[model samples]
Target: MAQTISVAGLRKNYGDVRAVDGVSFEVDQGEFFGILGPNGAGKTTTLEIIEGLREADEGTVAVLGLPPWPRNSRLLPRIGVQLQASSFFERLTAREQLQTFGSLYGVPAKKADAMIETVGLTDKADVRVEKLSGGQAQRLSIACALVHDPELVFLDEPTAALDPQARRNLWDLLREINTAGRTIVLTTHYMDEAEILCDRVAIMDRGKILRLGPPASLVRGLDAPTRVSVASGVLAEDEAKDLPGADEVSDDDVSLTISTRDPSAVVAALSARDALDGVQIRGATLEDVFLDLTGREYRA
Candidate 1:
């Protein structure tokens, strides 16, 4: 497929700090691409540069064949944006707020009503924005962004601060949007959300991408071995060391960590000995891979 978004050698600096340094990537048309990182990792900075909100110090950025910066008014109407912090006239009804945003994009009032329905806010359409819950407000924001029938959407932390049910609802909504052939570019810190919603993800830190691929492939590429933990009383150091395929066994009085490529082999070996008790094998997840890659350092 043709590229929907492209960036090369993207760099941005904020005085002493290089907010985005030497970043490059491409997002294919109709693909759900995500930028995953902790706060202050430059995910937002990069998004803003590509959204035409901020100018980059160096690099090229193209969205739907148009330069994102310099305000491509013609192209702006074809794209939708849901900012991390979206605000509106608190007193205006949800439907009214959407109508106003739609007018900004030159969309008709009828289209705005349709958008409100599309986001499942029809029952609450007449409710004032201030009365809407956080999730309701977020859904309204998404509906407003889509009111113009944009081919591409940029959602920044769309599910942040939402309840679990609300997050799940938004995830389903995003999947529906993507299934309808729209390209989505989102930035989020939630690993589980990225793993579930994104087709491909770029893990970024300190203004640079550390890894980029499908979440499953990225997790599979991790070198960390699967770990099996047992209650400290279940096994002694020598007993754990003797388990098949076990490596780097470490135990205290309460628990043990046993690294092994073949968790099944260890399980089978333990099962044969009838020594299994409180054993738990866990496959490595994206969270584990992320911590392994980025370390536990504080990023302010």
Candidate 2:
């Protein structure tokens, strides 16, 4: 794939606070790349610099092989950005909103209808923005961002506050968009979203990129302990710990949690138990990797 965006040793500081420090990564064409991090992790700052909204203090930055900062008007027309919260003319219809935004980039205003349809907002195309539901409005915001059909799209927390079903719907739409060849750079704290949508992810904290790779690989690479939970009917924590491959065990009156990498052995050992209710087994996940690397959980 062609390189769509590139940054080397990128740094941005506000007074003494290093919002983005020594960050570097490359986004390939048509790749769904994600930046995963907690609040104040500089994900937004790095995105802003790459989107040409802010200048980096140091480092080389490029988008489509051109400088994205210094107000590159030529590049602006080729990039789309959906900020954390996109504002629209409250009274304007969805289609009209896209028309206005497209006009800003000198693109054909008629494409607004096409974009509205692309984002699944065709049913609400003529409805006032304020009258739309949260999900509908968010889709409209994306429609406006994509009105120009830009090659590179930057999305900051696209589904931040949406309910589960709405978030899933947006995820499907985004996957469709990416499959159609748009390079998407997303910044979100949702591990599941990143794992499902991103071809590659960069876990960030303290204004730096801590780890970068495919989601499954990052989790597997961390070598996080596997866990098996059992509802204790008569077996005690001591017996559970003494089972084969049981590395660490914790117990309560109702359940036992065994943390280990070799779950097969543990499961085999538990087969002889007569009082066990059932077993729930799970492997390490992106959350585990995040915690292991950063020593903290991802907080939105």
User: Which numbered prediction scores highest in TM-score against the true structure?
Assistant: 2
Look at candidate 1 and tell me the lDDT of residue 20: 100
TM-score per candidate:
0.91, 0.94
Per-residue accuracy of model 1 over 87-167 as CA lDDT, tens digit each: 897689999999999899888999899988889999999999999999999999999889899999999999999999999
Can you tell me which runs of candidate 2 are displaced by over 4 Å? 252-254, 274-277, 297-300
Looking at model 1, which ten-residue stretch has the lowest summed lDDT? 269-278
Candidate 1 stretches with Cα past 4 Å from truth are: 229-238, 248-257, 273-280
Give the Cα RMSD of candidate 2.
1.9
Residue 144 lDDT, candidate 1, scale 0-100: 84
* RMSD (Å) of each candidate, 1 decimal: 2.2, 1.9
Expressed as tens digits, the lDDT of each residue in 1-300 for candidate 2 is: 789999999999999999998999999999999998888989999999999999899999999999988979989889999999889976789888889998987778767778888899888888999998888888888887788889999999999989999999999999998999999999997999999999999999989999999998998888778888888655777788789898999887667889998988888788777544678888988878877767764466
Against the reference, the lDDT scores of all candidates come to 0.90, 0.88
Q: Tell me, by lDDT, which candidate is best.
A: 1
